[model samples]
Target: MTPSNQRCSVAIIGGGAAGITAAAVLRKRAPQLSVTIVEPSSTHDYQPAWTLVGAGEYDVATTRRRLKAVLPAGVSLIQQRAHSFEPTSNRVQLEDGSILEYEQLIVAAGLQTNWQLIDGLVDTLGKNGVCSNYSYDTAPYTWECVQGMQNGRALFTQPPMPIKCPGAPQKILYMAADHFKRKGRKVELGFCNAGPAIFGVPFYAKALMQVVKHYGIATHFGYNLVAVNGPGKEAVFETTVDGMKIRHIEKFDMLHVTPPQSAPDFIKNSPLADAAGFVAVNKHSLQSTLFPNVFALGDCAGTANSKTAAAVRAQAPIMVSNLLALRMGSALSAQYDGYASCPLTTSVGKIILAEFGYDGVVMPSFAADPRKPARRYWHLKKRFLPWLYWNQMLMGNTGPDWHAKREYPDTLPSISP
Candidate 1:
């Protein structure tokens, strides 16, 4: 069905955290501009809480809301999938063969999870002791699998880099291990990571090694999950040994898989995409390198920052401010410092609040040593963060800027049990 030409002052490409927050901020700050969001989903999800949900600590239903309920009152919404982008004409093509023109475009469309990349995974994802926390439907099954297992090898696999919430794959591993410990179940846990290190930041990684040692988890670096024989209760992993590809198969009582991810196809095929298929934006300004009138943030943006919702919270305001400056014919003064936070859930009542900025500089919001796991951070993660996300962040309120680069010793802190 073809429709007449539609135009707006600004068009947002996704209704996720970045798009919704940007729209709310624009409406509050620049009420005169006509904003329209192009999104097909009927519900908005607070995905950060999914880790807790998978661990049986949170309810999955509470993480979702009707899309209309969260959107600001004045903004317009187009409930259709975006098929393509015509940046040269400032137009976006919808899946239904309609064109929407705009004076400015914001590509906040998030990345896509490639579940089918692993062979035989789709056929046995939610059953046969294989589950994942990446999806709302599968997350509950993760807890189910953990509870049903009495004692056996429970393998957790992390795909290559660039997945949203990079710590999520291991977060559930720690949670499951903690659950087993509390229940007096003797379950063997293993972490199969494609990356060489457990975490990106050396400061946090050093701390995490202590936790791993405490749990006695076998760490398999450079190993990537390639296939799952669910009925057979086996998983295949591949690794490179001196430029040669080697495959290893292991038996498991349960498996948690974090699939590979990439930018959505529509954005990847567009001219706005960088070589790696993410929106090419200046790291500091969050403005598209190709089109001055275009901007991008969140997981889709080609930036060095860790892809987390905390990154979205920091990027949205800067993107909105810089975008507004561009519209007003002023200098883009707002800058993003690549700040992101990860509350590593070491156990049910403990967390290591890992915060950092560009170049992996340790940034701590509190005075205590950031490497130490504490119960306070756990409460912050399980109680305060969800409220901050839904009530404050989604309402366009950028909270206090407490996180900053702080000086700490280069050596690792003493390991504790």
Candidate 2:
């Protein structure tokens, strides 16, 4: 059967947080422009809540909704994977041999979590106390592993950078440590990270080190998890000392692995990609460097912002605004300041909401000391944020009402548990 070519005013790739939000915004601002979303997944996940799910503080089912249920009205959905992009022709090729021609294109296809890059990981996952909060099936198992452990070594591994939610790998670790604390059990906890620091931002890292000391957890920087032997309860890591590569093996009763991630291979090999295999775009405008009509945002764009849904929230409005400017044949006026937020859950009821812009400048939405762990932020993470995410952000409410504001720090009193 031959699939006929379809044309539209705009085509959006990927249906995750970024794509759906963009479609909604486009539909609201430009009702006449035909907008189509190219996505293959039937389910959309609120991924930021996965850490809570892994900590037993949340139900995983609440983090998901059917794709059709959340998409904005009047926006078209193409339930197919994008095979490749042909920017010169302003068309996207789908896996089913159908072609979509568009006056403007936006690529929001997110990064790929390559679990297979770690040897023996695929076979061992979801068993032998091996788990990850990164996947839907294994997140619940992480809570299982945390609850079942009595007093043996529990290892949490964080791979190299450019991974989504850079603070997530440690968020679950904190949850497990807090869980063990409540039981009066001391699990020999270790954080094996490929990076040299606890976090990218210095202000937040200084505060996180205090939490690390509070837990008495061992920190091994420059160590990357490379393989797992589930049955034997062993994990292998590669690191360097004195400019020499070395292998370190550790045995554990429980292991939470955050896998290495990268741009999807299709995007990496495409002509739209930059040197590092991400969509080449102007950092501020998010307009493709090669094609004027094409734009990109989210994890797939070669931008310096931290890869988190909060970043997508800030980028969404800017991307849509600039995209419309392009359509008008006017200069792009909107710019994304590389804003990203990570609500670092330090305990079941406390979170340090770290929000920053380019060069790690603190850009707290509220003027409170972002360094302090607070109960309100936890509720924001657990209660308010999720509702806002579904009802507001994803629905294209990107005006001043939707913007995050910085208030006076001293005015907001901190609450203690």
Candidate 3:
């Protein structure tokens, strides 16, 4: 059915974490506002739990819910893909050629996973021991590959940066390593990362290096997975040294790939996008640089913060507050400090919760040493976070402001050279 040319006070471009949370907040704080979300999918996913799903620790079924069930009351739902944005005219063109007009727009369409970028990946994914935790369907196959492996090489590949949850590629690796250790499986593990470090934050990267050392996992830096010959169980990686590109092929019994990601096609081609193709918004205000009536958050926002649910949690309230202020003709007081958290699963029962703000400043909520892995954090990741996401965040509760002002020791120990 073609969508009617209905105008809304606020129109969200995606029904993912950012869009839903923002709509929920607007419904609670400003119930008079007519909010509409344009999303193609019928189900909303709690994507953070997919890491555990791939580790065989969490049920994949629990991570998803029907989109209509989770949406806040009185908000309109447009179950269609956004084809293009006409920012100058304050209108969005849907895939069905229907136009949606909004006084204010929120671009939270999230990033796109380019699976076909890797040669033969689409043909062999979920079979021939080629799997990935990136998709809900493929995630379960990763666990299957891990469980079936007795020996030989197990390889995990991480694409270049800006992918949602950068720590995800290695999180499964650690879980698989811990699983093998418990089951007395002698699988040789290797991590192939296109980036130069295990993590973006130096403080956590140092700690993660120790975890990699503990697992006896081979670390291949600067190696980018370019092709996957799944039938032959061989993976190809390209790298550059001395300005010359080189391709390296390695045989593997099992391979987990994290595909390259970018903003959705409609977003990339829109005038609101930056040079990097993400929604061009202020790093702090989240207001579109070109259009003040527009805002963005989550993976689609052109911010330096790590793309995670935690970032969306922080960004939603700030964006909502600022948007409301703009509507009220008041100064935009709420500012997002780029706070994002990454709970790195180093083992089955331990997690190194890496929390940071702009410019990689350590921002720990708890007083405990933020660098150490702990069992409590594991429980938080496995249990509390999911509950908070479904009940609190989606329910329009932002909780307390504990992360912004929490202080940490200045003289914390550093990694030795």
State the C-alpha lDDT per candidate: 0.92, 0.91, 0.91
Question: Which lDDT tens digits does candidate 2 get at residues 1-417?
Answer: 899899999999999999998998888889999999999999999999899999999999999999999989999999999999999998999999999999999999999999999999999999999999998878999999999999999999999988999999999998899889989997999999999999998878878888888888899999999999999999999999899989999999999999899999999989999999999999999999999999999999999999988998889988999999988888999999888999999888999888988888778877667888988999999998898889998999854322343433433333221
lDDT of 1 at 264: 93
Worst 10 residues of 3 by lDDT: 408-417
Model 2 has how many clashing residue pairs?
1
- Tens digit of lDDT per residue, candidate 1, span 1-417? 457668999999999998998898888889999999999999999998989998999999999999998998799999989999999999999988899999999998998999999999999999999999999889999999999999999999999989998889988999899899989999999999999999999889989999999999999999999999999999999999999999999999999999999989888899999999999999999999999999998999999999999999999889999999998899999999999999888888788888998888888888778888888988999999999988988888977669878888767666442
Q: Using Cα atoms with residue i matched to residue i, what is each candidate's TM-score against the true structure?
A: 0.98, 0.96, 0.97
**Off by more than 4 A, model 2:** 399-417
Candidate achieving higher lDDT, 2 or 3: 3
> Which candidate has the top score in TM-score?
1
Model 2 per-residue lDDT at 66: 100
Steric clash pairs (candidate 2): 367-409
